[model samples]
Target: MNISKEIVENVSGIDIVEYIIENDNGIAIGIINFGATITKIITPDRYGNLENMVVGFDNKSKYLKNFLHFGSVIGRVAGRVYKGKLTIDDVAYNLDLNLNDTHIHGGENGFHSRVWDTEEIYEEDKVGVKLRYISLDGEEGFPGTVETKVVYSLNNENELEFEVEATTDKTTVVNITNHSYFNLSGNFKENILNHYLKINADRFLPIYKNGDISGKINTVENTVFDFRKGKLIGEDIDKKLEQLTFADGYDHPLLFDDKIGKIELWESNSGRHMEITTNNEAVIFYSGNCFMKKTPFSKKDKNRRIALCLETQNLPIGENEVFKENSILRKNEVYKRTTKYKFSVI
Candidate 1:
């Protein structure tokens, strides 16, 4: 079915487009134009009652006014950049340091702040929405005029797949990921402490003294970073770590020991389960410890440790030599990444 295109007023004058996708199993996905955000994902439970599976503000103005990124597509880079500065092709660029003197999420006016042109593609067997945005030169202090496209598809097998592709005229770093907070139980759970979490990474990138990548992967054994054995998130969060002091949670990139196939993570609670898989080697597991409780943007209480974000992306800059290889997209070269989330009841 074709997505019905309609304009929804967000800000005073800013309008957002809503793309609706309906599946045979009564699952519906509502996507918005501002930042290409996934506003609502409605799926039926075992009792055939539908509920929103993701957490987000009801109004778009709240999204603009709130400090939380919230279900938006983050980019030109997702993680932190040291001192809000970077040298691309011998040219030094300074960006808006939004957090702790470091450039986070491509700076203050990154792709998440821009409106994108969208196209809804429908086939007999599959349905998807493609959103495209072009970032002009020097936009948010970035060098290149970058063209980015993200396609969100819902397959018959109950998979939410996101595909990201970008091209730039100038040399720049690009890391994009969807910031969706999932609660498999579909109950607006106060915390995910009981959710059995598993990460395939054996090591992680360590932060240096200056809040940048330390250029090394530390072992996960006997440390708070260890999720290799599938443990609860709260079991080791408050255990005192230097990196957590800044972000207040697990904002570090997990370095997977395996280089092939998919990196997988599973969460189970109350007979409901969720599984995430990605082609990327790293996944940033954030426990949302920085979010404010009972904020205006949060329809329900969104206090610290409420929702968790599993951002699959490259390591923060300078952390791994592998990023230099994995993220190097030369002129006319194409880079591709795919991440999928599937939900079920066990």
Candidate 2:
């Protein structure tokens, strides 16, 4: 295992450093301190051809306009908060309404837009980077001063792990997850429609047309949202179901079934397979429904369905009393979660 770092760019007088970690197997991942974002994940296909497996920008300037959230750390909260209203112990806090009167992914200046302090990790069996970010009290209209640490490690077993730990000085709600768009075909050779996915979820939360959670938990049985048996992503994506039409694709949250094991994704053409294991309760499977054709990506011809994201985290605390209560991080208590992605050839 090896880890290397180089100064990539300077943003507003702050130096942005990119760290590259690789294993003996030649699987590597590049991470930039800016947003602690993942720039590339180079892995081999069936025939030993390597290519980037994620959607990112080659030019540093394009990262500044990463509205897609690409491969960055999403913070404070992973999904939308109902109407931007949050309450903690009888104290009402109004968060920034950045997404059509809804507070989505922290806020306009969420963790995804900030530069984090990083430290390289060199271990006997693995190589990684530890990134830390301090969210000031009321920075994005939330409560408490939060100190978050995220460690990303790559091991010889072709496992990329994310371990997150956070603490707050006051009672506040916290949920963090990485928004990495994965295209197992490597260099965007084809859309993810043909990819077969199996999520260990039996229920899903429905969303409105505007992408807000409807606060109702429905079973996935006999519905288009069902992925229990593993099916091609595009098989029923274009169906005229209300949930499919709401977000134009799969952008809703699926509650994880503890009895089941892990989330699996397979790209047959490349023989690349990925298994996702997370301690979180839910995952948001986004089908890149909102990707605009006009926007330039690292590769050309990138449009909707070019990639997909499986964001593992707690259910969005959108006016859900149970979710809000469980997401609270009080003083002296540590919030920790782990998510792992293991890659291999079929």
Candidate 3:
């Protein structure tokens, strides 16, 4: 494996560097210092031709206004905090209600919007990029001065892995996850509805219109949320399900039974398959319902389901006590999570 870095551009007086890490197997991963985002992932399709699989912007200026959180890390909290509030240790923390009264993926100045210190690393068999960021105490209403490092690596076996480590000086809440929009068909404008997915989860955490996950564990035995048997993304997407309708499309986090994610996904059009494994408790499934493509930043009029986010993280649900405990990071305690996505052509 080999790694190379180049200054892509400067945004808001901050230098955005792009790192290209390629494995001997011809799989390459591109990451940027801005937001520590994965800008491109080139993998082979069914025809044995390399294609970029992740959705991304073409310039750095678009990242400055990346409200969609494309290929960036969501921090402090992955899901919505009901009414932009959380009571930790009987002390209240008020957050930015970036989305109405509910806070989603941190706030306007979340990790996804900040520039991170980055460096390249190479081991015997792998090459990767490590991005480090520090969140001040009371940053975004969080109660800790947290230091975090996120490493993204690609190996020879077509495996893209992420390892996140963090520590806080004060007791605070923390839940972090990546927000990458993926379209296995290798086209950002193409709908992923035809892709087949199998998630090793029997239940889902439904969210309200405000993006807050209801603590109630709803069984997916017969609902559109069921993916245990492997179904096309479009099979139940429009089945008149309230859960699907509430968010305008698929936008809820499904509680995993055991590990983080035992997800098997594939796009038939390209015959590309990907297996996702993680250590978190749940994975949020979000279809690009808000990518109205009307934004001046978008060159294409990308609409509903143009891309998808399989965000693996610990959800914050008011009704679940265990979930509440999972979000709290005590002083000097370390928070660590790892997720892997392996790709191949079927």
Could you give candidate 3's per-residue lDDT for residues 1-346 as a string of tens digits?
9999888788767788889999997888888888888888888898987888887777656877788888899887887777777787888778887987777788989998888998788888789999999999988888889998999998888899999999999888889998888889975436888889899988888776666766777898878888888999888788776777888879877878786569998998888899999998888888777776543234554556777899999877453333677788988789999999999999
lDDT of 1 by residue, 35-100 (tens): 888877776666665777677776656666434667788888887776767766666778788878
From the highest lDDT down, the ranking of the candidates is: 2, 3, 1
**So what's the TM-score on candidate 3?**
0.95
Q: Write the per-residue lDDT of candidate 2 for residues 10-63, one digit (tens) a residue.
A: 888999898999999999999999888999999999999999999888776677
Candidate 1 residue pairs in backbone clash: none
Instruction: Please state every model's RMSD to the true fold in angstroms.
Output: 2.9, 1.5, 1.9
In TM-score terms, candidate 2 sits at 0.97
Model 1 earns a TM-score of 0.89
Q: Once superposed on the true structure, which residue ranges of model 2 sit more than 4 Å away at CA?
A: 259-261, 298-301, 320-322
Q: Per-residue error at 250 for model 2, in Å?
A: 0.6
Model 2: colliding residue pairs: none
